[model samples]
Target chain A: EAEVAQSPRYKITEKSQAVAFWCDPISGHATLYWYRQILGQGPELLVQFQDESVVDDSQLPKDRFSAERLKGVDSTLKIQPAELGDSAMYLCASSLTGTGVSYEQYFGPGTRLTVT
Target chain B: TQLLEQSPQFLSIQEGENLTVYCNSSSVFSSLQWYRQEPGEGPVLLVTVVTGGEVKKLKRLTFQFGDARKDSSLHITAAQPGDTGLYLCARQGGSNYKLTFGKGTLLTVNP
Candidate 1:
């Protein structure tokens, strides 16, 4: 099925602690995305990456969050001093490319993060 | 930012029943996609509608795009317990495959 891969399916951290999640997109996919899904709500984009460069990060909170894809195949998202409000499901997705009008995206099982 | 509104945020029906959910947007969509997510997992794409007034059927599930390109609907016929999940409607906005999703409609098909 060639699915996207995510690590640490679940995470629990206390406030003021650091947490990190990892994702590996399907082979040959050039675009990757990170999203946060609150309970009972749809996923919201946190960042988008094209190859090794960031395309958009308008919704990402810069102060405590950071993401990077050094080789463009795998990515990591980190949050320092995690807040209670940061509790959510973190998802990673990948697509063949991101230049067209529309394309199919494959999602990973996701890492559920909980900050107490 | 574009706003998407989904109706009937939650629904529950007995097995073999029929139901429909809707997704409406404040801005016109160039393309719309539907996804289904089960508990403890990420969303899976169900279908994509690109043309105005387009209709696509996947077995017992039927999807329709509004003629004005601002809304879409998903209808499930003879839904079974396996049909229970959260249905999400998403639109491709701006350049480079940026997608904005609706809040989603949670459906529970009781057996």
Candidate 2:
């Protein structure tokens, strides 16, 4: 089965440090998403990308977080000056398309970020 | 803000037991999805319910969407230890195509 790929399964950084996570969606998928999952909670959307353009980032903390998908196939999410509260599991998911209602979402193993 | 509320935040049952998890919301959704996540991993899609009052079964697991399209339920029969995980319900919201997720139900099937 084709799966979304994520790098750095775990990351530990000091407060105010920068951290970045990468994700490669399955081939032919046009929709990618970045989510943060706190302990004992569901994943929360941080950003959504349709192809190379951002579709929604309302939940993303713009002041410290930024994401980009230059070629529309792979994406990178970066958090500058990470805070202790930023510690969570960052998940990446992809779907076939973003036109109407799509059911399935392929998710990666996720990058667990811890700031101390 | 769109939100999904899941009931029975945590459940622990012995093997071969039956259980049900629920997801509810006030707002209507175009589609609702159920996912399962193990420790240290992201959620894996289990099923998606679109039409109202739809019922779909996968192996020993049965899924049902409410007639009003504002609620859904997942029932597992004869659950085994392999069924242990966190189950999440997500709804597609707005034109952004972003998914709003529920807090999730953590199920532990003891052997």
Candidate 3:
């Protein structure tokens, strides 16, 4: 089975430092998602991208958090001046399509970020 | 904001016991999905219940969508230690591009 891939499985950074996570979706999947999960809470969507275009980012903390899918196949999520509240598990998921009855998302192992 | 509420935020049971987790929402959903997440890993899709009053079975797991389409349940029969994980339910509210997820139910099945 083709799995979604993520990098820097674990990270620890001082407050105000920068951190970035990478994800490569399954080949040909058109939709990618970035979600942040605080300990003991569900994953909250940070952004969604469809073929290099952002579909939704209403919940994204625009000031210091940004995500991009430059080519629409692989994606990067960056945080500048990370804060203590930014400590969480960042997850990446992808689906073959963002529509229809087959819109099941496959998730990567996820990147755990700790901002002290 | 659309909200999904999952019940029994935490559950613990002995192996071979039965358990059920629920997800409820006030906003109607076009589709509902259940996912399981292990420690240090992202969630994996378990099942999707789309229609009102629909029931689907996968091995020892059974899923049911409420008649009103705003609630769903997952029942695991003869649960095992391997079934210990976080169970999340999500739905597409206004569009397919966005998903609203419920605070998951954490299940711990001890052997």
Report per-candidate DockQ: 0.88, 0.83, 0.72
Docking class of 3: medium
DockQ of 1: 0.88
Residue-by-residue lDDT tens digits, candidate 1, A1-116: 78999999999999999999999999999999999999989999999999999999999999999999999989999999899999999999999873454568889999999999
Give Cα distance to truth, residue B6, candidate 2, Å: 0.6
In model 1, the runs with Cα more than 4 Å from the true position are none
| Higher-TM-score candidate of 1 and 2 | 1
Candidate 1's residue-wise lDDT over B1-111, tens digit each?
A: 788899889999999999999999877888899999999899999999999999999999999999999999999999999999999999877777788899999999999
Model 2, docking class: high
User: What TM-score does candidate 1 get on C-alpha atoms?
Assistant: 0.98
**Number of the top candidate by TM-score?**
1
i-RMSD values for every candidate model: 0.8, 1.1, 1.4
Candidate 3 or 1, higher TM-score: 1
Cα deviation at A10, candidate 2, in Å, is 0.5
The order of the candidates by lDDT, greatest first, is 1, 2, 3
Best by lDDT: 1
Residue pairs with clashing backbones, model 3: none
State each model's CA lDDT, in order.
0.94, 0.92, 0.91
